[model samples]
Target: MAADITPLIHRVRRWPRRVVITIAVVAVTLLAVRIALPYVVRNQVNHRLQSIPGYTGHVADIGIALWRGAYALEGVEIYKVSGEVRTPFVRARTIDFSVAWRDLFHGKIVSDILVEEGQLTFVAGATEAESQTDVDRRWQEVIEDLFPLEITHLEVNHGLLRYQDTTKTPAVDLFVTNLRLAATGLRNRPSESGEEFPAEIVLEGDSLGGGQLRLAISAEPLAAQPHFHLSAKLENVNLPELNESLKAYANVDVSRGKMELAAEMAGKDGGFQGYVKPFFEEVDFNNVSDENKSVLTRIWENVVQGLAWLVKNKARDQVGTRIPFQGRFGDPQVGLWTTIVNLFRHGFVRAFNPTIEGTVDPDNVLPTGDSADGEGVASEKPETPPKVATDDVKKVEPEAAAPTDQPSKKRTP
Candidate 1:
């Protein structure tokens, strides 16, 4: 028995040596794959992106932990238009997200998306030029095709946005920064009757021109003409800090001024309506800084600024206001005071008239774009809080694209 036991022990010890060596080979192989994973992911992502209909851009680096059910992206840049650009239209510092473990094994991809420290730029006049490099495709459709995955939740932290239109006089470079946004129920499909719409969304941020911004929008985009309701507030907008944007877009600059704005618009069926009222609490316009501007433009700005100070409503310590609005979404019949007070003091006198590029389209649901070609118009009720409201959206065409119910690269300005 002793002799048999000794031989068995020897064989057992030698067998362990082979097992240890096999285990070591596997460990090294896994480590190698893990180290090489980022490169593989980067190449695959770039290849997929380049294959998009009209998009050509790349992801810089990726951090992957597939077993942990998550991945992250470091730098992402996509051109505003086709070909190389001095500044890419979209850039993100970190984009991290996770997928459901159950979904992965089933071969179905679903994810909760998060984006951090990103910027979206809209260059107003990019079209399919004569150059072969430039290709124009429907932005919303392109996005839907690229990210066909199901999304249940999303968050955006510290996002920056810019709207630039160099066609203007001083060139418009409007910015909104420090944006934090969240949403759910974004990808719901409609029933046979119609789609349940206006996915709840909350957005808060600071305007680079000096103001706190808040927006609540309910969006349901599956319909031919999407339905939505949006309420926006711009508080304590500093007039002086907006010199470049104001001077370029509206032909005015200020030394010291402050304004608060409240707007609630709802659209349904094919039209929309709402009221936009600007409250100027304390405003003092100083001067213009156009060394090479036209004589008429310079003189006009100075004259308007002077008139504002002289005739500003003293009782309220403000320049008088009016809630002027119009619409293709439906005429809520917003009131514009035609009284003598408005003639002397109003938003028009102090430059709060919202326009698209150079064309004034009161029908614009959010004071951001142009009139729509849809059949219906919008109107506002007499007294309603910023509760759930509805608006309709058709494509803004070259002006700006329509935003989807989710947060993604296809976000429109």
Candidate 2:
């Protein structure tokens, strides 16, 4: 019995108590790290943004889902570091990111970034002296440097964008809303497929007056410098609604009318070349005569309207012009300012008879309100592509067919 008791004591002493204690401590430390990681990441992001030359902002909140290798941030505001206090150049309500599972495990991270709701306002500096110091690259560089990993995919929804030019005689606030975009193969290097266009992107949105707009783009981002091609089309814009937004910028009412605008552009390195074509099925310049108006203002409005009538193309019921643009993408207005000044300086000369550079089928243009065939759509938004008939079967004796059409030889062969 004494010998058996000694054996039992030895068995009790064999348990590894030290190892168990060590493992418990490690587990507790890991839990603490998991809880604090989001704060640390958010702080790092804020610090990095502040380092940019002319931009400063902070992230309101950040969260991480370690199991999925996903992270999200909310209420990010980036603005100019200035005393004048301008609207935030870029503001995002929420940004979500999800990484590929394999990449997550390999430590070579890449993510599909989603901007749930955001607004980017491009503000013209108060004076030419200030433009030099402002962050003017539209965040192309900042975005590339933001993440440790390359951005492989991108998506956006209901984003808003605006161009505000306070330097003009009357300030202009042009807006685009409900912007949606989808893109793939957006990495800094060649994509896994090694295609010429590393990224293919599609964009759609609404203009200030319910105009439908769409764009297609292909790009080679991994090259020594960025190279890309872009095409855009816009149609069925609401006319009167434009005046409400433009009222502050001009004295008289202006409308886009039954018009369409299309543009094609290409860029490499820092240079961009493009052409914008505007077509008008109809246009009207009206004088806003109200009891509140003074006599001189009414006279001026009428005079401008008259001038528009004289120069406008009236015979074909369509007016159009092709405008060529070239300059650095970073300096979007390099040549644009002169063009804008010329637009007003020689208002009727170009508008009256715009050079017709291209043509479009009016019937194919989607109707914004009602279909002639009585199709009911809740909204004019393009939900699905129009269907195409694919039946290739040949009718032996079609209703209008004569004796013998040439289809018999091909079918027999």
Candidate 3:
């Protein structure tokens, strides 16, 4: 019995050495993975980016945070391979994708993405090869591969959005700078109170020539069709700075003035209701001078300036009109006659107010009705006559406006 016990004790005494070796091996393996994970992720990202059709991209570096389950991409750039544009289509200084721990605690796994100093540029030319819209490719698939988790929140800080048209006479380049955007509740996690629109998005930016742009939206992003309420405003834009684009597109130029624009829209069940109001303040149309322009072009510019002067609201120093619209998601009816009437009304009867009307509401929007092309127009009712409402143009608070059951002659501008 003593001999058998001694043999068992010898084996038991060596167990610590075996355990220590096992632990050391695991520690070394984990250390190697930690050191190599970023390199592996960076290569994967670069590979996915290159797979985008007609686009090429590179990732400068990648960083990983093991504890938080986060990774950051630095100095990311994407270019359109076929375009003549020199600027990169997409440039991001840093993009961070992290696990949303708060949602994880609630038994919902999701991700939050932060994009810093990002720039998105769209170029247009005469040929298809010169266009860089990213619409032709499966860019979304690449984005999904980069972040496998469902995205519930997104933020963009100090970003830029640009549109360039090389085919224009003087070439067109317009940009929005210092753009900040935040969106939350995109996954539509169930709420205790059961909110209809579970997500909220806000965007604020500075347009070229010192104009401020703001947009806010409350939406059910996962709905089968479009369902949302939106409001937007672009104000105090120095019109002269927009001459390049205006001349190229509208064949008109502004020598002096500022502009203010506001719009409110609501959509549900594939139907939408909205209005776009544009107010020009102290505008002076530039004299058409280029000898290459057709005589009709110069005549049209003169007519537009004359009409603007005639409809100018003396009291407000503004020329403005409201263009209301409503219909299906893609096709909408514009109130051309109504818009013309509003111009005269603004000048003679009542000066148009440069604030969101707080009129459009999701609850008031009607579901889309079956109609064929050139059929009966939209069924939305006339907007309640304009009055000086709140001056909260930066952000609009959704209001429950009275729903109209009767068909309206109003159309969108």
Index of the highest-lDDT prediction: 3
Q: C-alpha displacement of 6 in model 3, angstroms? A: 31
lDDT of 3 by residue, 1-413 (tens): 89979988887677898786897899999999999999999998999899887888999999999899999999999988866666788988889999999989999789999988788888888887887776632876777789888888998877788888889987887787777888877774464457788888888877876788888888887777788878788888888777777877888877688899988787888888778889999998764444576878778888998998899898877899988787887688887888898999889997767777666667666676232232322333344522212233233222233212211212111
Model 2 weakest lDDT span, ten residues long: 404-413
Q: Give the clash total for candidate 1.
A: 20
Backbone atom clashes (below 3 Å) for every candidate? 20, 1, 5
lDDT of 1 by residue, 229-308 (tens): 66677777777766777766667666677877666655545555545656665765545344566877777777876676
Best by TM-score: 3
Worst 10 residues of 1 by lDDT: 390-399
Q: Is candidate 1 or candidate 3 better by lDDT?
A: 3
| Residue pairs in collision within model 2 | 311-352
Q: Which regions of candidate 2 deviate over 4 angstroms?
A: 1-15, 102-109, 128-145, 192-194, 224-226, 244-251, 269-272, 289-304, 307-316, 326-413
- Model 3 residue-pair collision total: 5
- Residue-level lDDT tens digits of model 2 in 1-413: 89979988787578699976887899999999998999998998888778777668888989798877788878888877754546777788788877866666787678888886677777665775333235445456667666556887788776776776666644655666666777778786667776767777777766755677777777786766556666677777655555544345556655435667766555665555555656655665553434576777677767866755554556555555555555455554324544444344334443423221222211222223122234311111222221110111111121231212111111100
For model 1 the local lDDT of residue 103 reads 56
